[model samples]
Target: MPQSAVDSPDLRLTLRVRAMRREARDVLSLELDDPAGGLLPPWEPGAHIDLRFANGVERQYSLCSDPADRTAWRVAILAESPSRGGSRYVHQTLRVGDLVTVSAPINHFALTPAAEYVFVAGGIGITPILPMLAEATRRGIPWRLAYLGSLAERMAFLDLPQLAGGDTLLVRGDLDTRLDLTAWIGSPTEQTGVYACGPERMLDALEQLSLDWPRGALHVERFQAKTFGESQGADTFEVVASRSDLVVSVDRGCSILEMLENAGIGVPSSCLEGVCGTCETAVIDGAPEHRDSILTPDERESNETMMICVSRSLGDRLVLDI
Candidate 1:
């Protein structure tokens, strides 16, 4: 179901910033390439890479450039108002030609085959949709995009020519502008899929509208970990790292990832809050309480893999592929 293939989740590379450009008022776009002039790993639409800054801060940014262009990878970073160290570092300290540590691409928001596609992007959420649109055009897939931005000057990729056409709708204004979600998306039909990415409130509104649609109709990606209240029914559980031949006891306050890391078993990970799918571990056996933000409803129901960072066991024991 729309699940993107992760080539190598633990693959890391050192790349140099080939160039930097100001796409918008607060947006900085960086083009990364190998210093030795070599091709990088191939990725698809809705894929993102984890960039580890010089300051040792890691953050995931969507691949906004054409996936076919393997010469270089592009990502846009918004100068976050609160300055979470990542945005500030990229804007102020990171420079062109600087070496950076980057993780291989990961995709939890892959675009699946559909008769018709609908995309809704809000502000920086437009990053992943850029490549999706390119792929859709290459495949001759019928699609429409609704780009909503708070301010005209702050929006990125405004100069993109692909966005100018009847198939796309651009709405820019302040907080006062109200969008009719139902009319914009219309009634769902057979084989019609909707992909949306934005702030919590924006996604929340869409979620409300999706209640009437068929299951697995609407797909979304989040910029942050959703608020899941305190752990409930969380008791001590045991995890068997099958590959490592070790069994670790997980405490109520501790997580499976933490337990493995503490036991000298490293699971290549980033965004330990479960927003990133770095710590996704294969579940050989046992039921897991999935709490990650990356998986689809169908994927969760399948219980094939579990994000050890935030997810836990639903039973007394869990067997992991590690």
Candidate 2:
């Protein structure tokens, strides 16, 4: 048997916590090791890693380091105690010189190789965008970054402008007072692809603003899940797993994948927020009510697959080939 090229390992780099500092009130910057032998992965600007600790607590954090460095990747973590234990562990327990296993870089938010780029970052969401700013600077891509934060020091990558050589825009003030999304995003040229990553409010605002722009021109990555409550919107949907047929009764708040997982069905998932395409499943028969951000319109129309984590059946009854 031969291995498929896609299944082969990409650039897998062992990153050690070289330094940790308070980037903001709640955010912490973690500098990783470059490895003595120059062992590192080639990554694009918006790539991130699945960091695995000894306790098997793994979380995905966007790489904040410059891609050109090639020696190391930096990630910033905002401690969320109520959620996954990764951030808490990283912030409280993980220290300098501590080693953590990181998967090969994966990119969901990417620069579309346009003539010019506009980057918007809010709060700790600036991690991934920082690298893109660096890339735009290095390539002379005519880029501008609107870094909006409550305070100037809260924004860790202050050196971006110097690195970018005046090709950057740093807007520091209370988001309520300082943020001007329309003026920043609306004024951009049609060819510009707007890239944004930030808190839900900011992303939602950007999403609304994006509605006015041309499709495929606005790219965003959300770090949190939509709180739709436990009530699934649809009644009684059946999902047909390729391995087995399971007709699960879906309440208004119950998602198809949640039903399956509750029934002891194992489906691959991470970030259950629909940002990561880990829980994607094939749709055998049914119109999918897609809630995920990953799928394109063509892919959704094809009706071949659905990200079971957040997506649901469009029709009353969906038969998914799980």
Candidate 3:
């Protein structure tokens, strides 16, 4: 499948897997390097790639390795309980030397500059946080972490030098009574950033706990789509895909992405429910009724981009940068 970039829409690379190793019990980390020993695109902490497997399954994985290392990119995959073709394929079928397709890194959960940071991670959610720790250390920023998992052996990269290098890391299993969010997170300050990525239950708890915190103090990324409400009452809208100069009417039941695809405009998309940021498109004109699970409230207010798969035009018509 073709992928779209914010700057270059038609950016996709076929990278060869250099190494695949078991990081935890069921967690496997894959190291992808350029096929011809060339440097890959530069990425910052918390950036992720839309990895398209040969089995025709595409999934998003966070770039967990040090961002300074541009020669190779590393991502850890968890073998979920119920097989979602992507993780299962990576665990069972994918080989070390096999070539795989990936999109340019896209980051919605970027490590913002802050006076300090509080990182909370659960299970496989630690992938993105692993890199942010290094970045924070390099920048000489004070930070603390509370890494939670069901079992010690289930957490990937617990032995990373960064984790060992810090005394503020509180890596604990679910049974550990000392994993107190109240004491660990404390009260948020104006310049302190609280970043978390995990299962819905943990994120939901963090969301409820951080309600009184600053508007943009806490950042979280979900592995699946949140509980989205019913369709909007004003569902019918016209979309002007400006790059292709195509206009189409999207009806009550249909989505902008569906309409665009039917019009022969193949925009890269996955998890059409709006969790993955794959179909995020630039908004040229008009306000979008943002519904994606990725963007923050600040981002939605900015109205710069929208996940066309699920979001609609707030007004009668919208001009999109296709």
Candidate 4:
């Protein structure tokens, strides 16, 4: 299948919750399977699926299970106290045997070929790294892990057999030991690939510290939307759908997505906040003032695509491959 098909919003599968188990405090691991006992779509490490709830709420969760397991897909979710209803619904309302609509696994954070790997995960961020550990082990690649949590009891999947080794460091908040990124992440080398998933503060620190590192040496996945510094002062712009041969004017106060919908053009969108990768349209012409958290600095420089939900044209007109 095409990459676009894999990322398409119209692609949805109804799967049954085969089992649910509590992994840690306020965290639950759910196993989803095809009700017909058939094989599910294959996924690589760092891929996530969008879970559509009955109440029309949608949330993305990273696949934590081994990618080799085609029979089932597993995701661990943390129940946030002030959740926008996604986590709470999974924790309180969702139950085993209930069918849920899930999208195909889409990976913006994919594992690249490297001689060695270094992984740093904080709290629930470890979910995506779990599968990466398995893949590295299978390929016999040298790897190390630093897993951090508030407490020992709150750290999920610590008891997993794969985590047993001297290379794996388990740090807790209540203890005196702390995660020092400066000390843990030394000067990045060409042979080493650094992957980190954590809170905004931790990611921010890592991003700043790795500035001098070799390009593409440091990779990160954020659980929250990035705080785009300062507004760009919104201005009216025009968008031309290359394929549709349609033109739409986006007002200063309105978004391109809103204007597209008004023109009867349907685009897949989930989190309109630019945190989710949905509504990412291919750019045929013109520069875009990228506002999405999912794209990297290099990707923004390429100008090959833009998330229409929050991003706008840098010039007066933008040509999109709709």
Candidate 5:
């Protein structure tokens, strides 16, 4: 389980962009370092930092640099075509020597201990896997990577010697070669773990393919909002804030976060689309119509938490630990 958002370190560092280089077509990698030459907070393989822009737009990007590098942090951003200003701002407005506010590293997609590992990545998804590969190599754990991209020229970090070895398979969409998901993800064993990060469709396909695999053996990180299945219909629901002794009515079209904000209640949120776990709230009572992609199957089954930004009460009322 992940640590509560409330307990997260209040680390807001203003780091200067030491360098910015194009890793691939439309993808830029930024190396941020402390202006005072201070050591930055430590981060693990799958951890991501929230990049807060001057325009109040915050976006999460995975830490792609080596974890042992305490003096600097690296992140790669792909200029999204129809971006909501986050990626475009980073690509156009951000530059070397510019100071940017960044939150401490958070890991909702943490890498767990395993004997053997198989990593699958698509396009910019390879950012998070880069560090994981480094960790695996350092630990001497057997691992393989299947990196898929639309084109060879647009693939980032392919020139790196670590990814150029035989253990890595570079699959280009423009080419006739296809990645055999079944062959790579064969019958799962308790000792083996599979980690994948990619587009929604790819993650969905992998999720379907790994249905019979051991629980917790397969882990994934999605770059986009997940598609929700048929729900019990968007009926109005009541939410009670246990500590504040407040009750708010949420309309069918309104989200709990929206309603709370309207009532002057503060809730921390990022990527209100439910991909980021920032707005996860404790559920004290009532069944929540889980819509977020951050929670695991077991976590959802436990009904201990819900992403209030996109989730709603399954029943008429929900009791929250807020």
Candidate 6:
């Protein structure tokens, strides 16, 4: 079957499991193959695919392989009780040759050139960081990887240390001590870029520490997003999708994007909580609330940018060029 629209428009891709491994107690490295073609769509670092299940549940997982590797895309799934069912399905029911529909890789977090890069990863978060480490290594970019795992035995990648070469720093929390990210991310110089992916607490700490650094110096990808502040704080507004000639009420409980979608207006979106830039649209009029994490304050102030995922309008209404 084709991995895209002709076969399944909803997800746009498919993964026929080629290999699997017991990375940890509850984590597994699943190597997925292209459905029919030689390779899948090209992607960059920090890209992710939305995995769809037979039961109709869809969840996103970050691509764990180097984007340059077109043969297959790798992802690590960790089973958790509160899982919305995506990880549980992959960890338990998914088999070596089973086919799973996946979406084209979409990237919101991308690597930028830095004199020095420090990657802080915790447990399953290490998957995405592995690709970046490989890219850095290939380019001879000076970098350091601080990986924290529950135990040496439970660390997913057995080849992690070897892959990172001499720049790798593995911290086994089950053995020595809990990691102090502040000591690792220290005073950020102009040329340094700090990239981290892990638990919410780790991300929060990184965010707080990054406040003192340059605006774009710290790059982060959180699997779970901090929710957008409710629209009650927003002024009740209207949005006119000029092209559609649709006027939608941007109410206190409804976002402009939600209103549009509810009205059967389709706007490309992923990670609707505001981290991914998929729902970004051009604002023709009215000041935007700028609730998304992807855009800078300056970009938001320009009114040329808007993240429909969470941001709403400031005044009576907004006129979007969409």
Model 1 agreement with the true structure over 190-298: per-residue lDDT tens digits = 5888999888888878888988888889999989887777666349989999998999999898899888888888777778778888788899999998888888778
Q: Candidate 5 residues 56-95, lDDT tens each?
A: 6788899999999999999999999998899999998988
In model 2, the worst 10-residue window by lDDT is 1-10
lDDT of 6 by residue, 137-252 (tens): 77777888888887887777857543545377778877868767778667778788778888877777887888888877787787776655455444677888999999888777
RMSD of 6: 3.4
Question: Which of 1 and 3 is ahead in TM-score?
Answer: 1
The clash count for each model shown is 0, 6, 0, 0, 0, 0
Q: Which stretches of candidate 6 lie over 4 Å from their true place?
A: 1-11, 161-163, 227-232, 293-303
Overall lDDT per candidate, in order of appearance: 0.86, 0.72, 0.86, 0.85, 0.85, 0.76
What are the RMSD figures for all models against the true structure? Answer: 3.7, 4.8, 2.4, 2.9, 3.2, 3.4
Question: What digit string (tens of lDDT, one per residue) describes model 2 on residues 111-143?
Answer: 778788888888788888887877776777787
Which ten residues in a row are the worst by lDDT in model 6? 1-10
Residue pairs in collision within model 4: none
Q: Write the per-residue lDDT of candidate 3 for residues 164-233, one digit (tens) a residue.
A: 5444555666556657687778899899999999999888888888888988888998888887678653
Pairwise lDDT winner, candidates 5 and 6: 5
What candidate 4 gets wrong by more than 4 Å, as runs, is: 1-10
TM-score of each: 0.93, 0.80, 0.91, 0.94, 0.93, 0.89
Model 1 quality (TM-score): 0.93
Give the Å error, residue 151, model 5: 0.1
Model 2 stretches astray by more than 4 angstroms = 1-15, 33-38, 54-56, 80-84, 161-166, 174-177, 187-189, 227-233, 243-254, 258-265, 282-284, 293-304, 316-322
The CA lDDT at 187 in model 2 is 55
Off by over 4 Å in 1: 1-10
